[model samples]
Target: MSADLVLDGLDKRFPGSPTPALRGFSLTVAAGTCTAVLGPSGSGKSTLLRVIAGLEEPDAGEVRIDGTDVAGVAAEHRGVGMVFQRSLLFPHLTILDNVAFSDRVSGMNRRAARSRAGEYLEMVQLQGFGDRRVGELSGGQEQRVAIARALAAEPAVLLLDEPFSALDPALRSDMHDLLDSVRQAVSPTIVLVTHDRDEAARASDRIALLEHGVLLHEGTVLDAYRRPQNVRASQIMGGRNAVPGVVRDGSHHSALGAVPVPLDTPTGSGTLVIRQEDVAVLDGGVGPADTGSIAGVVESVRVTGARSEIAVRCGDALLHAEAPPTQRCQLGDRIRLMLPTTAVHIVAD
Candidate 1:
């Protein structure tokens, strides 16, 4: 059965390091919920996952699953399954045997273990590849088998550590959909570690931002994107256009103009993080701008087959706006940029 996962004051440090990899990390994940842990490299995203899986021991803090502390439990006995970036399947073992390894290790009869493994393989859409050697499958197929292997253990918590990192862009999307399907098939408490923001936004029920080995922010994907806790969190969460602004209780004053955001703050200096996709480029034909419009000269335009990314220079600040390929935007043309009140995030840190 699935269980809620909790961590409190989790601190882990490698010997000789000046700072801890995980510092005072705490989180509560509801049962059968998928929480994506997001962070840049060396930010303890993987370390936190390892600690929860009992692969790494925290110097201090407690890891509780369903309100029971499991800090002293061995890795295999923790009832957690991990799918690493690379599928470390045994070369000599067939796909079925590799998937069933967990069951066999748990002392199940060979026939029963094989049957259970077959079920997981079918769930992962690898129904007939059971007898194929692990060396013969493609990378994406191997990852599917690995996921099946992890689930075959019947783990209460599934931890995926960048499971789709090796797959190509197209395959990555497919794998994402596959993960969503798996979640629907068997709702287990899942913790996924990823650097891909779009993937996290699409798959995660909640996105937890981690930075410099610290848990920076935790919220719904849209909330974290709309109102990031800090500047660092904003950058990682796809705040491409970072604008320096001053908060004036009701609105923010930027190079463009004083635009109202969906937040109230004490009158102080702050920065605004605007998402490129959220900033709509208005052509005279698209629509008429309302009150919160700032005019800018188009600096450059980049076309990527189906879509165009236009860079506009408004005073000292440059805004990157995503436009359609058919939109006739040219360099040196004066364009009006409108940042929706809800799209402009006032982050004061």
Candidate 2:
């Protein structure tokens, strides 16, 4: 069965450390859903996971699982299974034995434990390799064994602390697919700690962005990427354009000219934020002036993967835009940019 995990007002500080690892950190992970905790190093992502796993106690606040406070619970009794960044598999045990360790420790007979362990190995697509030693497996396969071991316990809540960070891009993508399959089959409530934005978005339903132990924003993946709450949040989410502007009378006025904003937008100074992908670049033309398109000169162009990243200078503001690699352009080329009013998000400066 899945469990709802909650961290309420958690504050933790290590001895002799100048700053708290987590300060007033709070978030709720719904049953059968995954929430990725995303932040840079020293952002307390790992510390939060440890607190939930009962491996570390918070100096203040509560760690609740399924509505019950588990202040004094031991790590093993918390009904949580954690997969660390490294596989940490025992060298002496076969993959099957390693996965069966949890069940055996719980007093299950050897035969029944191995039987259940086999099921989890199949779930990870390693059914035929259970007899192999840890040294015989690749890094990705070792991580798979680690996941199988964690799941073999039938944990109500699963914690993954950047388990795929060290894998190559292709292998990391494969692990994500495996995770999706695991969620479908068992539906364990999951809390994923990761610094990679793409991984957080691809692996979880929601994102909890942390900064210096502070919960900056907690929302759906799309909202975290497109509707960040502040300048720092925007930057963290990879927002490229943050044009200084003023919101007044349901419109934002800036170097890109006035664009319509939501009616409830406060009338004050703000920053107009738009993702590079949202900005549509067009050829220079003397067409209709009522199209709300602005003219600019291409300052730079760099092709990255399948997209071309472009920088355009319009009046006093330098805007970043993205286009297909086929849309070739050189520096000093005149271009028209269409900044969709719906795509323009006004955030606090």
Which candidate comes out best when scored by lDDT?
2
lDDT of 2 at 342: 78
Model 2 clash tally?
0
lDDT of 2: 0.91
TM-score of each: 0.93, 0.96
Over 228-271, each residue of candidate 1 has an lDDT whose tens digit, in order, gives 88888888887778888788858888887787877556567888
Give the clashing residue pairs of candidate 2, or none: none
Q: Provide the lDDT at 155 for model 2.
A: 88
| Model 1 global lDDT (CA atoms, 0 to 1) | 0.88
User: Candidate 1 versus the native: TM-score?
Assistant: 0.93
Off by over 4 Å in 2: 285-290
**lDDT by residue (tens digit), candidate 2, 1-349:** 6999988999999999999999999899999999999999989999999999999999999999999999999999889999999999999998999999999998999999999999999999999998999999999999999999999988889999999999999999999999999999999999999999999999999999999989999999999888888877778888889988899878889987887876667889999888999998875442456477888889999999999999999999999999998888789987888888778788866
